[model samples]
Target: MRVRLDYGKVGLEVEFPDHNTKAVLGLKPTVPLENPTKAIAHALRQPIATPALADIARGRRDACIVLCDITRPVPNRLLLPPILETLHRSGIPKERVTLLIATGTHRPNWGDELEALVGGDIAGSYRVVNHDSKSLSAHRFMGTSPNGVPIWIDKVYTDADLRITVGLIEPHFMAGFSGGRKLIMPGVAAFYTIQRWHCPRFLEHPLATNGSVRGNPVHEEALAIAKCVRPDFIVDVILDEANRTTGVFAGDLEQAWLTGVEFAGKHVRAAITEPVDIVVTTCAGYPLDLTFYQTVKGMVGALPAVKQGGTIIIASECAEGVGSPDFAQALWETSDLEAFVRYISQPDVFVPEEWQVEELAKVVRHAEVICVAGGISAEKLTNCFVTPAESVEEGLRMALAKHGESASIYVIPRGPYVIPTLC
Candidate 1:
């Protein structure tokens, strides 16, 4: 049997013996919108719980549109132009409108990447900039959320008379789902605010896992912070396995996002007959798999699909390396698994990418992770307590060697995009 996994700009294909493969779980295929542009225009005009976008932009002069960074597959090129045109038609000048890349703690999007993110027309016509989470002077503290997260956001976004966020809604490892309020929390909030919410205590919550937000502290805190900013409008999309927009949610931030979350939950969540001995997954591909930091999501997403003490083989390009300096050092400083946990769990431990390590530790606690990638060195994988393999075949062979030939194998080509929950 052969399965193709998304890798980098292209994709990777793997073949396994018919008897060795159990299933290849992915998002339930959904029909893409016939015309996503038309859908966006329709959504903006008839949105959930809010007036038409033109009405909302009627009297506003300065507008800041927050967009997802490179890690997400938001199809900003298709999504942004219509929104910008709507703003322009409403009399809001393009110069007065700013396109802010909500990169969170990630690096800036520039040049070709920036042009691709918002398209050449939008990128060149408007004032495009990236949010600097570490620039202490750039963030303005908006006071603390009731949930205790200090609400500090990019001054550019807060100062704007009209604040709008555009992103894709999908299952997130820690936040239950991504989009909506997420565009504001880690997206543009100050480093301290992001660090505090991503603190070990919040991430370790049982409800913090995928498809659950009722009691997820990370989701709740982020919503609180978003409320503090009170973005005037939000546009979030739900994509199918093919990265095509399946549904569009626009208008009021909370209502529209919740609507999109409900839509995403139905398609992304999959039921498995039982836990498998060996699980193979990817970090989606391209933009998302560009860094090791993003690779953890694939690990966490596959954790529940693997039996306790079972092996999980993850393949990601990790083209951007570990994606974070502090995360890399944290992994390297620790001697072994025990030290890794002990070091990160320290009372005063506070680092930018520390949450990724904690999430990885949780994955390590439940199952063994083997990484197969050419971009990230084997030494670096070892430092992070993950075994390294040069290819998927080699990794699967290693896993089968330990678990035996009969070990049930489950493959998730899109990784975190599909939630595999054991029945």
Candidate 2:
């Protein structure tokens, strides 16, 4: 049988599989909705529109750094050119600009990855670098957080004449959003600040609280400290489901974060309305090693809304394997999370992963993690993390049954990535 087919409405057409197939409609995920680069350019160009890129370029600024979030979905590649171009237009030579990875507590970005971000040419011209948690000199304890906990920061932040930061505003495990305080707190804070924020498990008051460092108080305090150093500009971005920039916020750091948060709210946020028993998710292959560290994002983001001991189904495709070998070996050796934290006595003075490991320990204690991936060994995956049935469907059904078939559920196909879960 032959049939006339038309998908004029969707601008697509395809042959059917059956003798007589039903007319179907579909949408393409890769379809370019709008050019994000142009959108980001427009947004940044809008706010203040004061210090034109050219204005800053002609200046006598000595050094500049471009700090961008490596979390999945942010269109750093798209956002980079216009801003860098602006810098070039302003007269700040490419040689003077340094591109630094703002991984903070997240795993560092490699050289090739850095190039893919800022572009091959820019990546080549400027020195691309990563944050070194191991360097004591890199970190300096300037003062205590507003509540008095000591706040140590990266010294490089002090050296730059023009400092610009990039990040997406999304749901966080503790904070309402992931930008603002994020750029400085874990993004560039020394090991000490990172340890205090993560070790005590202070999600109750996730930073930017009315006041107090005991709360995830690092964000606000960090922001205050950044102001002391005075970042010439900040380019806070908002991403869509594809992680491309839906908006770019320029000017003041807090204001840019607020703008990105509002814009991101439309895409990254899903209100539970009622807590779910089973939340199937993944670590969107980022600081989570595209797979190795990815599971953490799911655990953190889903922790608040998921019922205690509720099952969390995770899917990570970490091709490089889970965590660094040193980290992996350390975890197997120590079942004691606190011991891990206790042994690393001077975090402001010691290893960053030791602090991160402690936080990972806390999450493991609280949740039932079920992983789904192909790159890693099932035995190792099962031993260290929970490797569920081979597929998302199998895992979803199992998770649903564990929570009772009637229990509400959420399926995060993209897995665990950053972007706070705002209420």
TM-score per candidate, in order?
Answer: 0.97, 0.76
The clash number for model 2 is: 22
Q: What shift in Å separates residue 70 of candidate 2 from its native position after superposition?
A: 4.4
- Residue-level lDDT of model 1, residues 1-423, one tens digit each, is 999998788888999777978899989878999999899999999999999999999989889999999888888888888888888898899889998999998999989998778788777878988999989789999999886678889999999999999999999999999999999999999998898888767888888887888999889889988998989999999888778889999999899999999889889988898898999999999889998889999999998899999999999999989877877887777666556556656776775577888888889989999998779889888877899999999999999999998889999999988999767
Candidate 1 Cα deviation (angstroms), residue 193: 0.8
Clashes of 1: 0
Tens digit per residue, CA lDDT, model 2, 1-423: 122211111111222223222221111132333776676676556653336444554674754554654544456667777887887777778787777777665567767777666667767777777787656678777776654556676766657777777666655544456666667666777766665665443433335221122344435555665555556667766554445545667766666666656665555544444445666566544433354554555666656556677777666655666666656776677767666656665434444355446546556666677766656777777656465566555765676567665665555544433322435
Best by TM-score: 1
The number of the candidate with the highest lDDT is 1
lDDT of each: 0.89, 0.57
Error of 2 at 60 (Å): 3.2
Candidate 1 residue runs with Cα over 4 Å from true position: 337-348
